[model samples]
Target chain A: AQSVTQLDSHVSVSEGTPVLLRCNYSSSYSPSLFWYVQHPNKGLQLLLKYTSAATLVKGINGFEAEFKKSETSFHLTKPSAHMSDAAEYFCVVILSGSARQLTFGSGTQLTVLP
Target chain B: GAGVSQSPRYKVAKRGQDVALRCDPISGHVSLFWYQQALGQGPEFLTYFQNEAQLDKSGLPSDRFFAERPEGSVSTLKIQRTQQEDSAVYLCASSNRDRGDHQPQHFGDGTRLSIL
Candidate 1:
């Protein structure tokens, strides 16, 4: 079974400051990792995906994540935080054999202060 | 529609009542999925469908929960004898199977079910 753990349940950052949300995964085989964001009363929006192509994956809204195989981590990062970045972020994994279902982390709520 | 569309954005039902949620995936999408998101938690997989075939349903919580994609374009999730524990946001997503598994699934706004 594959699973993901989000290190922080909540993260707060001031505007123009760097933001980091940690995530770790346990999988038997190579995993497809993704980051998704959801605002209140809205749908989950894909931020970025890492499919073994590049270790450093860039996503929309100036977000990016680095897939570190040795560290067993896929941490999301942003150079600067904006007020609109306040939302719930999730780390998801797809196992090698079963690509149908997505295993999601508990989630990390980001709060951006002005 | 332009994206995945779910009906009855908000539903309030008494306990023991039966409720059904609908999902219309993007046209030509070969894969559809259902997930349950409880308050303060990430969404959990409930079921999956490939075209019109119901391939995997290992995530269904109970026998009372059922989902079907009769024609492959639209899907429905029905819950019988609803319990308070079943109250959550039901999300529907679809992806192009031919595009490979790495493709991100597009999600709907979700149907919030409140059981009383």
Candidate 2:
């Protein structure tokens, strides 16, 4: 079975400052990874994805993530944070050779301060 | 794009009542998925469909949970004898990939089901 672990339950950052949300995964086969953001009472929106196509993946809303196979980690990053960035984020993994079910991390709540 | 759409934004059911949830994926998207998310928790996979074929249902909690994509487009998830523990947001997603992708899943706003 595959699983994902989010390093933090919450992360607070100041607007115009850098931001990071950490995630790690365990899978028997090469995994496909994704980051999603959920605003309060809203549906989740895709942030970015890594499918072995690129190590550095860029996403919407000025967000990006690096798929580090050696570290078994995929962390989301932004050069600068915006107050609207405050929301919940999820790190997910899909094993290459399974039923293609997504294994998701518990989640990280991001708080952007003005 | 219209993304994905789920019906009955909110649902309330008494214990033991049967309930049905619906999903409409993006036009021409052959792969569809269903997930269940508890409050403050990541969504858990419930099932997957490719066109009219039900490819995977391993994640569905029990046999009481059944999902089908009748015409390879709109889908419905029926849960028999709903329980309080069944209360959660049911999310539906779709992707362009036929067998499914490791790519991000496009999600619906979700059906918030409450059991009282």
- Highest TM-score model number: 1
TM-score of chain B, per candidate?
0.97, 0.95
After TM-score superposition, the amount by which residue B95's alpha carbon in candidate 2 deviates from its true location, in angstroms, is 0.8
lDDT of 2 at A73: 91
Stretch of 10 with least lDDT, candidate 2 chain A: A94-103
* Per-candidate TM-score against the hidden true structure: 0.97, 0.95
Tens-digit lDDT string for candidate 1 (A1-114): 889999999999999999999999998777899999999999999999999999999999999999999999999999999999999999999855443578889999999999
Q: For every candidate, what share of the true interface contacts is present? A: 0.74, 0.68
Best by lDDT: 1
Write the residue-wise lDDT of candidate 2 on A7-102 in tens digits: 999999999999999999887766888999999878889899888889999999999999888999999999999999999999988855435767
Error of 1 at A112 (Å): 0.4
What digit string (tens of lDDT, one per residue) describes model 1 on residues B1-116? 89999999999999999999999999999999999999999999998888888888989999999999999899999999999999999999999884347988999999999999
